[model samples]
Target: MSQDIHRITQATLDKLREEHHHLTTVGRTEIARVIEAARSLGDLSENGDYHAAKDEQGKMEARIRQIDTVIRNHEIVERDGEATEVSYASIVAVVYDG
Candidate 1:
């Protein structure tokens, strides 16, 4: 019962980390391309493409920042062999009454 540990399992963490890497790399590249295309459209003051690119850039950067914070604060939960009880990071299957 560690307080600082994440509620997700190691497998989920791995998947999230992989997605984070993909976002930080490929996402940034795509954003850059969008900005570049927008920039090539002449005047920045009245350019719709530029505004759209900026908006998308803002959202992408926000997501990147959120992912970075999550990685920084994440604590891995460990399970012991002798413990039969489930805790954080435990995957449970539930039966629904509904």
Candidate 2:
């Protein structure tokens, strides 16, 4: 079996890359710091702050992994093409007969 590939704009790819980098680095670092701080407060059995921080970290890590997969599996394509094809992003609405 072969994995399916998708096309993405360079801008989108760049944005996802930035998010992945920040999530893996800054996001993880900040969460770890928060966890450490919460741990310092003592009583892990009923530590709401610690649990919340851990939950947030899990969500962020999941997003990071998702973006990583997108960056790896998709191909970046230029959006400068002259295709006249209508897309959701380029759709315009005009009210006819007000």
Candidate 3:
């Protein structure tokens, strides 16, 4: 399988790394705390807070994995000069999926 490519600047890379680190460390710790607190409250079958915390934890983990993939397989492109050749890929494609 081919690896997905992501061209990013150093600053962007640094920011992504920071976010990943924060989520993995402090964020994970906080979620675990919430889950523990929720678990202490009666039955596990009808624990809404516990389920919600688990759901949030899953989403957060997915995000961390996404950031990890980019960090692992991405390339840093330094733009030092003006563009000489214009092609279809030369134009930046901005799509708002949200």
Which tens-of-lDDT digit does each residue in 1-33 have in candidate 3?
888898887878999999999999999999999
Off-target runs (Cα >4 Å) in candidate 3 are 80-98
Winner on TM-score between 1 and 3 is 3
TM, every model: 0.69, 0.80, 0.79
Q: State the lDDT at 51 in candidate 1.
A: 96
Select the stronger candidate by TM-score from 2 and 3: 2
Model 2 TM-score relative to the real fold = 0.80
Q: Per-residue lDDT for 77 in model 1?
A: 70
**Predicted candidate 2 versus true structure: per-residue lDDT over 26-69, tens digit per residue:** 99999999999999999999999999999999999889878877
Candidate 2 Cα errors over 4 Å, as ranges: 80-82, 87-98
* CA lDDT of each prediction against the hidden true structure: 0.78, 0.83, 0.88
TM-score of 3: 0.79
Model 1 ranges off by over 4 Å: 1-6, 78-98
Q: Give the C-alpha miss distance for residue 25 in model 1, angstroms.
A: 1.3
Best-to-worst order by TM-score is: 2, 3, 1
Q: What lDDT score is found at residue 19 in candidate 3?
A: 100
